[model samples]
Target: MHILLHDFAGHPFQAELSRVLARRGHRVTHAWFAGDTGPKGRMARTEGDADTLAFLPAGQDLRYSKTDFLRRRAGDIAYGQELGQAICAMKPDVVISGNTPTEAQEGIQRACRQTGTPFIYWCQDFYSVAASRLLARKLPGPGHLIGGYYRFLERRQMRRASRVLHITESFRAQTDAWGIPRERVSVIPNWGALDEIGVLDRNTAWAQANGLGPGTRFLYSGTLAMKHNPELLAGLARAVTAGDQVVLVSAGVGADGLAARAADGTLPGMRVLPLQPFEVFPQVLASGDILLAVIEREAGTFSVPSKILSYLCAGRPIVLAAPGDNLAAQILRETGAGQVVEPEDTEGFAAAAQAFRDDPAARQAAGAAGRAYAEAHFDLERVADKFETLFSEARNGL
Candidate 1:
């Protein structure tokens, strides 16, 4: 079967799935929005990749401004049109899309319907919900109305999708509200890219380059968008045990805010750097004694922050600031992989950091637990089998 898998943010594990499907004798073309300045995994064909596997970088030259609503909307429309063209050209049996804007998703699904192809709505997060909150903040008066239109489009897309693949079971409450059938949706949680990321110690060359480590480095390595609070990051920097520093690898609005604070001496000497290349990501991750992730309370449900999963693969203890009910937080609590504090709990977040830094044995244990979780969850063979089954079901007109 020919498959088109489009993860707009160009995430790591999604691309890995494309490789696995191709190895299973199905042709898979993994596509992504190359212009997004987010942490990406191996999107290119490796020497070991099968000929059936390929990569397509959609909108490699498009201008994407995360903070500008109108500009982003326009970019989404353009990307959607380009992706629709790819759909017609590839003529794949089924297409799976995630990390896509509502407008783009609507367009892609319409293209699938027009071409008589099955479309899988990979529900990584609720884009319409996020857009609504962000838009409301940006445009006070007509924001809800604008968000309502996108929500309408999203509902239609959901109702028309061939199948909805969700990353978490909690999404059923929302989809069920849309009156989608129980069988039409499936929950397959996201996993870390264990195949590509190897375990590295903290004394690597990456730490040397950064002039940071061999000591405790708490790394927050993901999208620090509107849903994230830069103040919490600043609080983290101040809260960590002295001699330990916090690293923020991000871009866009949050990056700007953090950089400003760092410059003004308000951020307490935290390292605010732009997103690094994926080639050094493993070492970058390794430089951290405790990995970090943050999401605001408003974005607790709408944002999953897959960086938590990536941190798990790094064999590092995590210090996450999010809602207790958030899936990532729940996982950390259940697995003892790391510590989770409330998004607004600056003191607790700091305490968690200090505790981890002070106790090497406990940190090592948490890191071990995290790696164990990654190993158990990311069996590529089993994962590919599930995708293949879904594709076959879609082909059978299920």
Candidate 2:
């Protein structure tokens, strides 16, 4: 089968999905905005023919560039037309859209209609709710307007999709609210690279090279956006009085403020390091004694953080700061691999950190459990099989 994977707001997970599907003996091609810089692994040939202009930032926090913003809304129309052309040319058997923007949604839908192919919505995020809430929280006036428009597009897109693969049950529930048939939606959680499980010793080598001393390292990798709550992260920095050192190696956009604040504080044994290369990410994650999943209380407490999958695969104990009902928290509790604390509960997070630091056996047990859960449930090969089954069913109209 030939597959065209599209995501206007480019994400690494989309690329991962393409790889999984392709490895299962399907031809895959990726269509993304020109400047979206997520990883594109061996899944398929990447073609930057997708309809939206990229909004990439100049520096580390990687904010959307002004050029991208000025061109995005209008370019989306062009994007849709071009996407339609691509579909006509490729004539793929299945079309998958990964969290598309408004313009791409309409474009991809048109392409699917014209090509007479089964369409799948690989839901990485609830675009309608997530994007609207994100914009409303960050940019009120124009953001709210755009968000409302995006929500409208989201409903239309969901209606047109032949199948929807949600990241969690809660995410799938959102689609059910729209009166889409429940059978059309299935739960497929984000997966970790199963190939990464064998690299434990590499973590030591990476730490030595990076000057991260041999001690209990608690890591919080990824972005530090507004939804990430800088103040709480700062509090955790200040609260780490345990003998075990606290080192934060941040990568991706949005960590300058946290880094600046961490520097000014007189917290002993705390170091904020720069983001490492992707090659070393697995090792970096493995080297850590514990992983901290930080989401602001206001960023909607129920959303699952992608970092959890990586942390689980790395075999680390997690201290997740989010609502208890969130899918991530539920999974952590179910597997006995981590503990969840309220996003704003500094004392609770601090206490949890201290307990892990004090109890090596407990930390090891949690790490082992996390690794086992990741291998059994979050393996890429296993996830690929799930997708194959779904794709086969969608193709057969089952």
Among all candidates shown, the one with the greatest lDDT: 1
Give candidate 2's root-mean-square deviation (CA, Å).
5.4
lDDT of each: 0.86, 0.70
Q: Find the 10 residues in a row with the least total lDDT in model 1.
A: 207-216
My TM-score estimates for the predictions, one after another, are 0.96, 0.81
RMSD of 1: 1.5
lDDT agreement of model 2 with the native? 0.70
Residue-wise C-alpha lDDT for candidate 2, range 14-128, written one tens digit per residue: 5666665665567777676654443322333335422221122111222333235456565656666777777888788887777565665777788788778898887776656
Candidate 2 least-lDDT 10 residues? 52-61
Best by TM-score: 1
